[model samples]
Target: MGDVRAPVAGLPPVAALVLAAGGGRRLGGRPKALLAYRGRPLLEHAVAVVRGGGCAPVHVVLGAERERVAATAELAGCAVVANPDWASGLGSSLRAGLASLPPGCSAALVALVDTPGVTPAAVARLLAAHRAGAALAAACYGGGRGHPVLIGARYFGEAAAGARGDTGARALLAARAGELVLVECGDVAAPDDVDTPQDWARWSGQPGQPGWPGSLGQSG
Candidate 1:
């Protein structure tokens, strides 16, 4: 909620809001944000993706291991918003993230930490859609929709109010289906979630493969 990094001029400035607060109950109580990926925390990777995709002054919503993540991850330029009620679900994180954005932002490109498979290209697609003037938009994988939904400044309040529990922004997206822009990202990305042990095993690298850190102790 503090002052955000001043955005560059001319180009439309979009703030990247990363929802990394989930407790990862299904993943054996591990904070999904702290989960290791390619020698860094999953939360860090999510932040990088958003930045690479052209979002300015990224904001990350942290819940589980809020302190540990701060001590460990390299969040130099990001604004970290800790949600004490993170146990409530993605809804709380979503609301907290939206509220934390500073004034003068043009839009919010919401991303999730658990989604490593979501590429920067997918995020760029959402940014493109937003530039085209879509009030609401989301990345669509194959026949279904997925993460990193774009909420323009006009609908920030309504979207935050409607995001409830584990549903996140699903309810809002459904209600605005007629106006929502679905950018197909299946060809360039996979919307697989690291919500289970098996899911982690696949994305976190195999034994000896360059993936998650060998020891979790380095996390803080």
Candidate 2:
């Protein structure tokens, strides 16, 4: 297995694809990127996570209220791409993000903004797990696999082709399971996401309510 390890060194630059383009159909049309969290926009946190996870030249996909998000959110140092077809599904955003990588980028660490439970530690583990130059790696919580998937440059075309609808690289991961590397991150982070109103309430700091301060998976 080529001594699978964390914190791959002397490797080509790894760019981050932070998929923040969701229209938030489940949240009554509110854009997930603009959602309030930790005194800043959710997209800001996602970008910080990507940068903190040891990736460079982070690319963010914006949709729905793209203009508002661009204007209000602190997206400095990130390459923002607007996905007009964002409503089509997560696949389109994934494709757009992948296509926007800077020249010479060898791999893309894909992450979702909705998954507030994911932390930079999980990302570091997945980055460390990349075996060959162009290998597949993903994070796992307990027994189930979760987001922030790693797609080597060699598989970018195939991964982008399979990226349709809400299934972002899952089809590829399922078919290439034999070649995939699963990094167990259950101890360092949570893989759950803030998808529903109940989740929002749980994270919301209300009187007499046990709020999840930094519970959306902040770096410890």
Top candidate (TM-score): 1
Give the alpha carbon lDDT tens digit for every residue of 15-63 in model 2: 8999988777656567878777776788888887777777877999998
lDDT of 1 by residue, 1-220 (tens): 1112233469668999999887777676778887778877888888888887778989989998799888877899999998999998889999999999999788999998888888788887888788788869899888698887998888888889898888888888888889988999998778988767667777765443333332344332
lDDT of 1 at 187: 89
Whole-model lDDT, model 2: 0.79
For each candidate in turn, give its C-alpha RMSD to the true structure in angstroms.
5.1, 5.5
**TM-score, every prediction:** 0.89, 0.87
Give the best candidate by lDDT: 1
Model 1 stretches with alpha carbons more than 4 Å out = 1-9, 206-220
Q: Candidate 2: which stretches are off by over 4 Å?
A: 1-10, 131-134, 206-220
TM-score for candidate 1, please give it. Answer: 0.89
**What count of clashes does model 1 give?**
0
